[model samples]
Target: MVLRSSFFVASILLLTACGSGGSKNDSLPSETPEEKGESLYVLNCASCHGEDGKLGSSGAKDLSVSKLSDQQIEQIIRKGKNAMPAQEAVLETDENIKLVIEHVKTLKNKP
Candidate 1:
């Protein structure tokens, strides 16, 4: 009887403790634009362009020395250049593309 009572008490305590933490989804901040871009880049571009954006795995351009403006970059991303395929299908949305473009700018080697 004592053993059963103790188990019931412990189970209640464990459940109460679990519920005290509150909602995990509310605790986390929404993904920032740069973070969103980094994730997308890793999924889509990092294989060829690399984490720093200069790997050029298959004739991809060296992004560190890239001189293209945001507009130019957008065009290239959507239209494709040389071995790079058009990203319109992959990127899907303008906002997604914009976030990636901003992150890519941060990769350039500053003069």
Candidate 2:
């Protein structure tokens, strides 16, 4: 009887150990660079700038008409342009900033 009880307790512990049943976010697949960039942009910029990036809230520029190159844009993002805040921490790395720049370019062609 003791052996059976021990086995049952071990099985319970093993089952829980094998499966977290944690937050859904934990189970999600890792985002690609492009997807990560898009998410970051939306979270960081879309509110005042608008989804198309032409709202011009608080002096934000219309990105579709932006003449700035990727390097220039990256600088502005890292350093801040007038009302916009510097995003160095949020962007976290040069590669992340570049990926976000590409997504911003797509907004230019989008309606």
Candidate 2 lDDT, 1-111, residue by residue in tens: 999999999999987876765545487788988888888888888876777888888889988778888889998999997889998887888888888899899888876
Report the number of the highest-lDDT candidate: 1
Write one digit per residue (lDDT tens) for candidate 1, span 1-111.
999999999999988887766656477778988899989988999999988887889999988889999999999999998899999789999999999899889888543
Superposition TM-score, candidate 2 onto the true structure: 0.68
lDDT of 2: 0.85
Model 2 ranges with Cα > 4 A deviation: 1-27
Show the colliding residue pairs in model 2.
none
* Model 1 CA lDDT for position 20: 67
lDDT of each: 0.89, 0.85
